[model samples]
Target chain A: MKNIYSTLPVIGILLLTLVSSALPANKPPEKGGVLPVINLPIPKNPTEKVYLGLSGDGFFKIPQIKAKVVIIEIYSMYCPYCQKDAPGVNELYTFIEKNPDLKNKIKLIGIGAGNTPFEVEVYKKTYQVPFPLFPDKDFTIHKACAEVRTPYFIVVKINDDGTHQIVHAQLGDYPGADPFLELVLKASGLK
Target chain B: MQKIRLANLIMVAGMLSVFVTVSMAFAISDAYKGNIYQVGTIKPVDSKLVVKKGNQAPDFSLPSVSGDKVTLSQFRGKKNVALSFVPAAWTPICSDQWPGYNIIKDTFDQNDTILLGITVDNIPTLFAWINQMGKLWFPVLSDFWPHGAVAKKYGVLRSNGVSERALFVIDKKGAIRYIDVHDINKRPPLEDLVGALEKLGK
Candidate 1:
């Protein structure tokens, strides 16, 4: 009887360990939160001057767009899902570009999580990605964005003070270009 | 005593139920969802330089993903070879490394070089992972069976039964021109590979 009692607890502990080990290690960021400030190299032009608060860092400044809405894609060149969704993302870029009003008020960019400058260039060339894409080689930008999975999307509303608020944050690929553009347009109050 | 034995059996049965539940939960978890496993922060690997530059490259043949065997000497005297040894398939870093190479075929073509991607994973695993990313322009070779035999010869095999993320550039003369055993957790700069290939031209 005593042996059984002791063994029961051991089994319970083993079960707990196994269950916890299967849980996801990374969690996606919450929606409707302020965008994290991440310093990245300016796409295709790292040496360009950009201001961050009082500092004169040459790195790409986040949420620095002049538009009212900015969409940022956190992706990696190695991510298969991101590779598959590349065309859809391109379509979304085209949708925005063709709309004269949205084109002036909205901007999009891709941050290649863990991708080097060369790697980002290859991805751009392969997909013929029109929007500016920057390499977050060290994952500094990825970590700042809460280490979200590839193809994660963040639609932000740029505030008057240059700060931005995340209006919508999605962990996976958007359903399609139409709905994706709708979500961005609605979230940014353009619709 | 009979009653006590029955009670002990009940206890054992209860324990088995818990074990079964745990196993079932794990079986249905996200770990098996595609190849996206949760890997922690990047761990740096300090690799030893085993092969010297300007030395004759060792020759070996391995099965490729396309169902044909590939031999290193087959490319000798005709094309320059770049051997890329990644740690394992399905992991975060290794998964992205090759896909990035997929788009840089032009860089290799510009220098008249061919890339041979090698991993210790079996053919099926490599095939599934590579296919997930779309068709690759270069041949992907499997170093299984002998279990990282090629990586072992190059001294890039990690102690954990995987290869270190390494790149070796061999000239058309079958001589090792540049060797980079990069940090296992990070991607090697593309320009570095391009620069090495250009040096072989000169």
Candidate 2:
């Protein structure tokens, strides 16, 4: 009994530390909120336009994503963490794309916060990102999203009314694909 | 027995806290997000522009984060050099600017040019802060010991100890080809720098 009591406090502290490190201390006020409907110009790339199911050239909003859940990666070509996180994000997209059950249900998109179309194209060409990425040259979307830090992840649940309910928001990058997918599944309640 | 248990618990708590604090400080991706001190807005340009397009770039040797003295004149006749001077280490715009250069290493390589990143902070400070960007392709030099001597030569040293967010493109002949004394408040568009580098060949 005495030994167990001593071990319990140690375990508790370990748990506390793990929990604190997992979530960024300065996470933006993104969770439990409705992501504003920001419009993006239709992509010029035919494949990208088809991938996002975009039609008619003017603009499109996040609610138009035909999926049960959408994972919006708010990133910047200039952000170091975003550059670091690129490969892992591409891996996540592959995992979802290859998996039949979750393929169409979960969609991945990246927003280049404060990035011009030229900058976005450079990032796409550099990272070989498979998904559609939109540019926010004037930071219109970034300001709408509370100017969140780069490499920020927002998991939004698509409701019947087409509103995006942000279920989870994480600052910094997530390590590894499997564990991060588990997190996305859990956050979006897909599992 | 109870007193010993209390002591043990206290000891464990202390160790855990230290471990956690150290972990946060040194973690690869988390370090940058943890220490971002926001400065809303400041002076656009606090120093005069002295180096003109055709002038010879003032040369200097400064210690880099990589533990070597980088001399501008060393690259003369060998490679074109783009001297990137940021205000200070760990500040808002300065922190992310160099990291942005990481993705565009090809542009510099293709242009047969090398970038030398200079900041007013000392090596120790620059090391910890630059680590936030992972390993940069270029050398990051410290202009700290002589207090922005290199920056002062280029007329980029601010009224304060910090350097101006400026970039100098010196051709193979050591003739300064381009000079951008950008607004201190924002990142100078990467296109602007790349455009300058592309212009060197012409």
Best of the candidates, DockQ? 1
Residue A173 of model 2, lDDT score: 54
For residues A17-95, could you state the per-residue lDDT of candidate 1 as single tens digits?
5544433334455567776666765443332221112234356456776678878888877666777788999999899
Docking class of 1: incorrect
Compose the digit string of candidate 2's lDDT tens values, residues B1-202. Answer: 7756665676566666654433221111233776876554567789987789999988899999889998999999999999999997767667767877888899999999999999999999989988878889899999997898889999999997889999999999999999999878767777889999999999
Q: Model 1 clash pairs? A: A40-A60, A78-B96
What TM-score does chain A of model 2 get? 0.81
- For model 2, what is the C-alpha lDDT against the true structure? 0.80
Model 2 stretches astray by more than 4 angstroms: A1-29, B1-31
lDDT of 2 by residue, A90-184 (tens): 99999999999998888889988767777888899999999999887766566556566677788888887877788888887577678889998
lDDT of 1 by residue, B1-202 (tens): 6655555566566665544432221111111245566454444564455678888888999999999999999998999999999888877667667776777788899899999999999999998888777789999999997998888888887777788899999999999999988877566877898899988889
Candidate 1 segments whose C-alpha is farther than 4 A from its true place: A1-27, A40-63, A159-163, B1-34, B38-49
